[model samples]
Target: MSKTTPKYLLLSLPTSVVPSHHADDALEAISTTVSAENGSAAPFSIPEFKIGTLDALVQQADELAKLESQCQGVVAKVADALRNILDGDEAQIERMMVVNDKPVDQYLRTFQWNKVKYRADKSLAELIDLLHKEGASIDNDIRFKYSQYNQVKNTLATLQRKQTGNLSTKSLASIVDPRTVVQDSEYIETHLIAVPNSQEKEFLKNYETVAPMVVPRSASLVASDNEFTLYAVTTFKKHSVEFVHKARENKWIPRDFKYVEGGKEEERKEVERVGGDERKVWGETLRLGRTAWSEAVMVWIHVLVLRVFVETVLRYGLPLDFVSALVRTPSSKQADKAKKNLDDKYSYLAGNAFGRDKKGRVQRDDPQDMHGAGEGSAEYTPYVFYEFEFN
Candidate 1:
């Protein structure tokens, strides 16, 4: 009979013996053929055959088992290498090794455990919480200190006012003692004379009596006009009264004095027209009066510049909080520039030179270009105008 080619063979058999077929289909055929050859076709059955035939079948089973064991060993080695690379520490490596010895499902569970543990250990959420607490504490401390300082300063001022009376007096005789009068004539003559005592003693008595009536008395080294004469008294006593008198006589009226009571009514009216309230206008006028006309004009220009900056930044949706943060560095020129720009922008908006657009959004005007040229370099470079829109 011609040899019938076997349709299927055991996995352990040499490739030459196994007919070329799909592995799953061949395995099914082999089981069917083995069942037919044996008395029972169940996988556990062994046919009563010659010793040589039985040994061949047993050897095939043993080889198949060994092949499966080798595949499992290769997988284990691969898993160990992967664990060493992924696990950052010894404890993690040991845990991974143990998990690798387990079934696939158990290994996945172990991985999740390690991931959660690692994240919990190094989380930055706690650090952020601590920072918030510290910042709040510092803010509270600063507020408390400011309040305390203000209260103490106010208390000192009240006490000083209670102690010192009005120091300005048109009658200098009230503070000074009368000169001693002499009586030397051929005939008896009467003459007015001061009580026999030093002029200093008389002035001391007058100061002690008048100090209580001084108005708005305070401890500030420099004083306002209302407080000026009050401090002058103390200064005169500490220094020579003659020196104080000489200084007061030489005092050329300050530009501020020009606006004080009856100076320039026109300037005061102009300030009032620009600023709504008269008091505020007066303060601004006084401050401007203290400086030269050119300097005063520069201040107005600076105010306009700052107003442009604030409005533009606001238009760009930059948070006010962030603006403060960005400009917080004390010595940074960039920060200073940002601050000036914000101020200028705010001033422009307040002055009503610029208004909102149709959509009610603040419209920013183009800033004027600035340039710098020196003797050495004739080239002029365009400078950026930092500006912002304000609502």
Candidate 2:
């Protein structure tokens, strides 16, 4: 879809004007009068939902609408997460949602509600319960995978940073040569010092005089970065603390390091292990994100269809007879125009149960409206309307 184009709008109306297989009448009106030249309309197939009694459906309608809203929010959130995982490339999200080898736009234009997954034979309450479980399961899986990937990614970044940072901040394990380190000495100990390039001469000239029991002429250059040059100085194990203090007094920063045999190889192994783990977790999380996006979208559509069915029953008051459609307007301006056109054409469907605000927006006359209704009640648009966008 283009940047200006909004996604499909799910609409339902009484079949008195739009009969089965004669949806072209409604589509023609929508494309010309509703969306104008900016958008298109198509028939959205809604499965024959099992409708219980009137009281049961009224309560279920509120619950179903809320669930549909929640599922739509999840779709947007998961899309954002998947985009972030792919370095903020929006196209990658569309690639993940391809259905039957079709692109996202094509799939949505010719979409078919999945009936096998949400069997219509089940009652309204059963379907609501199923959607709740599906939504929760998808949320938990995405949360877990994203968390795992983030942890591994952060650890690998720290390790890779040390490999490139300056000596003062970098790890010393691989930079220090094992041969130059005085290891396993009874009294003599090796200490690493970071000396500024300008102070290297002074450090080398007075190294042996820093403390008592210092090994004479033991100061040797180890490594050099842009900021500081690393040197190793040898002194007595008992006088190591005094030597460090005196070195600091001369503005030489002492880096605490313990030399071990095969330390370089150990460091290399640790970096490699973490890097491998990062790659594995990244792939797993991406796969999980893609699957969750698909599942969540399907579950959301099912909830939307349920809301349409229940609202049709309560508004039309008995035998189920209505035509639901999917309308896609290219821009928000066109969408507002489409809604105005729809309200103009279908205002009579509201009968005595609904009213219009000062701005002519549809408003329910139910008791819930007087006392500040919930999300489900507040969303009751005239002629059974709900709008959603694709990521």
Candidate 3:
């Protein structure tokens, strides 16, 4: 009820010794300790992550996610506007007739689906510039961030295409809060418990055994999800703390929120305001500003920022898989000279220069291809291949 009292005890505050996001600091310590023990630096330096870089990137990503979702809502509005104008469905006419007390044909004004993409366009341009400015273009140690950024950017673009299929956007349904199921009570304290899905049945079966630990007849099932179950635990207000403690001891996490001031209904309304009403303010602004799409694009760019930051932390300091391979080129007067140089440079590598089939798959193994060595030789085995065309 009170913000001081965590609705969800498990998520209220971090229980980890080091914060989950402080891997950079942890790595820095490990690297220093290792180097000191060795009494010297290694042949190559490891990529060092910035202190608050990941936090900043994640924050940016959160902003972008909001933009992306809001933009989709805008796209929905635009589609509705266009539909109303073009079709003027009977539903709209009937609704208008009911409201204005006029015949359908008397209505002169119609809807127009305005584009919000233009403003989002400018935001995206600015975001790209920001990434280019702060990106790991320098320092090969961290340059991998550039590659990860590109991957994330490409994926976002692909997802965008998938999101707004056929130039139409559908609004996703708002979440239904489970708290509505609980009845109001003053002397009784109600708590929401989240249990891991793995042991959901076990917890339900043993619910009675644990309920008395906090208060008699305290536990009741409210809702469940694929990953977790939410249980409503009602007990005497004096025993609320004990209930929460016992609940945690049984691996049930208290929902994270302040339910004391106004209780679950107030918390539910706050969540609804955030998800439904408050979120539309931005959507309305985008519709007014004509830049909804632009905001969406900017948010996508922000997603790439997080991708780069996270990828760098997880992969940059680790061993990499470096590779080299011979490439085939069309024979030409220039090709002969280049092929000679390539051959000289990689003479040590085994050659499998047989021509590939039209499908780009390697041809069947032939004795003539490898000469006598082709007999039972793994080097002459047929292998699948792909030809890449660059634009």
Candidate 4:
């Protein structure tokens, strides 16, 4: 490859995951990469590849995601063993569920220890070796880069959602445009503040008196819920810090509702640049016969494929809606057509996958299992495809 050439992968793995009765059945496919096969020829050779960087990142992301899925069985087994050891076998299974970072750390520790354990039986040792090798794929570095990629991707999605008027209900109802908030008066800043539901009346009656007293009628209530009452609070920009502290004293919770300035984007960008080896593969179907791929289809496929990819790979670990929201299909009847096209495409991998039916509710045998990862000794429900509709 020339010095100017960028990395790419020639992926041909099945769109949906297939269960391997024996863990080693899929290892060879996982270890293969298109870049490894023919060095000089670019993967599929995009015609004037316009979205090379973004597409490359998505491919890398998918590759990592696929590795995670293949490794799930081994990881799931390790997590269950550790959770059982920590919670004791006698505890109610529900109470022993491990759902967050704390318990995951415990599972990781035990898993690493198992990797180092001494075993005499050849079969047992070989199984342990497989787990250890797979475990290496999910080490801190992969997890770190993968998480950063998700954070950045999610941040971009949030911005796009806002642009498309698809922001969260809370954000839409309570967040005033910063530009509108600064109306007429240039010195005042309007903040979207949330005060405790219990303190709603207190804020109405005493916020002005408690916060060194001000005019413009204290604060205007924008929206409310059982737990919080959103408010548009205005004060001189110079005194905003003191005003914030004063509001806090009266039970207002600080939330930086400004998604653009919320720092997640900046943090995500800083972390995303730290690339990993998994991102070398550019497209799953970009190999030999698929060389006719175009830039536009590739972009749409990236979103659609990653939505299905992450959904299946991290089924138990991600939100049920997953990345389905980011899948850009047509606006009307064609949307339904596109959804069907995707659904039919993966129909072969349907048996092991979890999905949402025509209704929005996720189709699952156990509802609580949706809590993910630490919920039980459950296996990942593969091929987790969801309809391309939003609530």
Candidate 5:
């Protein structure tokens, strides 16, 4: 409700350390150590994917890791956009991520690793490629849909603005009476003028003498608001331009209007049409946003799983054995504690690749030292780790 997205830490460890029967023990240990009052964890299902050659898997690991970050960013952005569309409702239902039409938290708890959707027969590289392509496609689609909705919404707003503005700027279509307009008269032309409320009596007194051939007593009040009064007047057709100029010089606003049959009705119809268009687009954009968020989250998780599989192989070397998990902390402090506990427990996984500082903590190499390590190797944690938020 406070707009703080729910954060989760994703981790994967070698199977040798966490046997199948005790799979939940590692997560339980981390949660209990972090905050027994607010921390939770679940089995993050990662299907045994086919690992191609070592070189290809390493390259794809780096690419998929970056893709995971991208997917995370896309999910957050789409959530924010959807939140705005919901009128900043802090308690909106879309605060949670969904996958397969189920909330992400529930899905993770009951995860069975959809082997049908992502065939394990396919190489891990192919699966990573597929997930990356889907994530990119979803991101592009959400952007386009949100943009289109804004365009239609803006069009409707512009139309509504003219209906509510002051006399000098508002549309006169619905206010001007057909009978008050001098229609189809060759000698007499009807002109609409907006005079300030303070100058109404002055306009009424001098309108007849402002220009040549003005009809006496032809001026009639058409409409009025707090700041201005609209009046319709008749004058000789030849003096129409001069009449408007003199009216402006006298601090009155001359409005351009062409009389049309059923103009008011037409204005109503136009508003209805645009209003309907805006509503339709709004519904579509909202639906698209929801679907895109789910797709992006799933793709992001898949990329993370791929990173875990590949990194586990590269780091642990082999027989396709590791335990992956999802950890949820109620607060950032708990998240920090979970990270610290996990680091202390798994620092040995890094082995000789990472060194120790005077504080006896595993000192991760700086980005500069990680150069040529790989594209996604810039940040090297003891074990496979990624975090994302959904609120």
Candidate 6:
């Protein structure tokens, strides 16, 4: 407490522990210095000693190291927790079934059984036969029988329909005739169909007896040899027709569609005329192939809100207290607006709080229900109700 006493020693020791004599000595010296500098009558008070530079630096370094260790531990725990959350059996199953591809409903509907049939070299007839052999009676049900009959009828009908001239058994036979076998001239030729009217003509045209062939016009068949070319071409054409029919059924093109000549050129010109800003706006709608701007805006807003909420939770844990405060605040209008935004954005979070499952049925994880204020409900539900309550 002497005038020469070091600041560190004074600061390191407590005020209460400092001797009264020393404090009096320090205060008197400080008062004299202040009086001389200010030339004032008022006595000066000595300020409390502050920690020295070396001590402060050492303390800060120690705290920083401790903080670093704590942060590392927290990071490790979070990583393990996230991995466990993502790698759980249910999560893995959901990831495989839902995330890796389209939803189960979409997969089941869009799955091309026809493509599978073609790849496997299996006919619809063979499939039906196998089913029948397995005791699956497709005959008992009239609808089933009708469906099968209609399919066969349709195939034959399509073939007959495509015929250009007068239909005849001979002509039909010619179209559907299988590939000719390469053999010696001595081998006897087998006739699958011998129409009465064409027997003499058939005998006269024996050397010109061609097997039934379907010629397709697809690019895939362009390089095929003549022996297999017809089959490939026919298959491609049939498939193309089927695809176009399906597209039409799905309303992919307008019913009043007129074939556009140089449509891409027109589109490019329109884009250029519209300039960059309008072009971007037009591009978003075109890219999504839809015209619901409000819905798109809502979706983007929801994504942004969810992203912020997730980042907040990941950084500082769930903001339940802040959310509750916001919900219960006196500014009902602001609260209502906030709740509306949340309902539009985070309704899925609410749905996850209350949802059910049934056997053999695709369960909805989120169910839409009444939300927001002044809707005959005194209590309001938080988005993370289940997480906050249970966790």
List the global CA lDDT of all models: 0.28, 0.76, 0.36, 0.39, 0.77, 0.28
Go through the candidates in order and give the clash count of each: 29, 0, 18, 6, 1, 3
lDDT of 3 by residue, 1-391 (tens): 3112101000000112124434344333323432332221111111222324445544543444344344334434433332333254545423422102322122111211122422223343345344333322212212233334334445444444433322111101122243533346666656666788877787667765654534455566655556666666666667667667777898867764332533445544544544453334433432322232233223332333323333333222233221111122322332333333323332222234443467754443342423111113354211111111101
The digit string of per-residue lDDT tens for model 5 on 107-168 reads 66676655777788998767877777888899899889899988888988888877888999
Worst 10-residue stretch by lDDT in candidate 1? 40-49
- Per-model TM-score, in order, reads 0.16, 0.78, 0.24, 0.29, 0.77, 0.14
Model 5 ranges off by over 4 Å: 1-3, 15-38, 90-92, 95-97, 177-222, 231-255, 352-356, 360-362, 365-379
Question: In what order do the candidates fall by lDDT, top score first?
Answer: 5, 2, 4, 3, 1, 6
Instruction: In model 5, state the lDDT of residue 191.
Output: 92
* Model 3 residue 215 distance off true place after TM-score fit, in angstroms: 2.9
What is candidate 1's lDDT per residue for 299-327, written digit by digit as tens?
A: 22222222222222323223221111011
Whichever of 4 and 6 has more lDDT, that candidate is: 4
TM-score of candidate 3 versus the correct structure, residues matched by position: 0.24
Query: Between the candidate structures 1 and 3, which one is better when assessed by TM-score?
Result: 3
After TM-score superposition, the amount by which residue 96's alpha carbon in candidate 1 deviates from its true location, in angstroms, is 56
Give the range where candidate 5 is weakest over 10 consecutive residues by summed lDDT.
Answer: 366-375
**Positional deviation of residue 46's Cα in model 5 after best superposition, in angstroms:** 1.0
How does candidate 5 score on lDDT? 0.77
lDDT of 6: 0.28
- Stretches off by above 4 angstroms in model 3 are 1-188, 196-201, 208-213, 225-229, 236-242, 257-391
Instruction: Tell how far residue 15 is off in model 2, in angstroms.
Output: 2.8
- lDDT computed for candidate 2: 0.76
- Residues 1-391, model 6: lDDT tens digits: 2122110000011112224525444334323322322221111121111222444434433333333233333323322332332344445433333211554333322322233322224332343233233221211222243334345445444444433333221123223223331123242222222222323243224312122222222212111121221111222222434433443343222111122446545545543444443434333322222112112222222222222222223222322111211012123343344334433433333345433345532233433342222123343342321100000
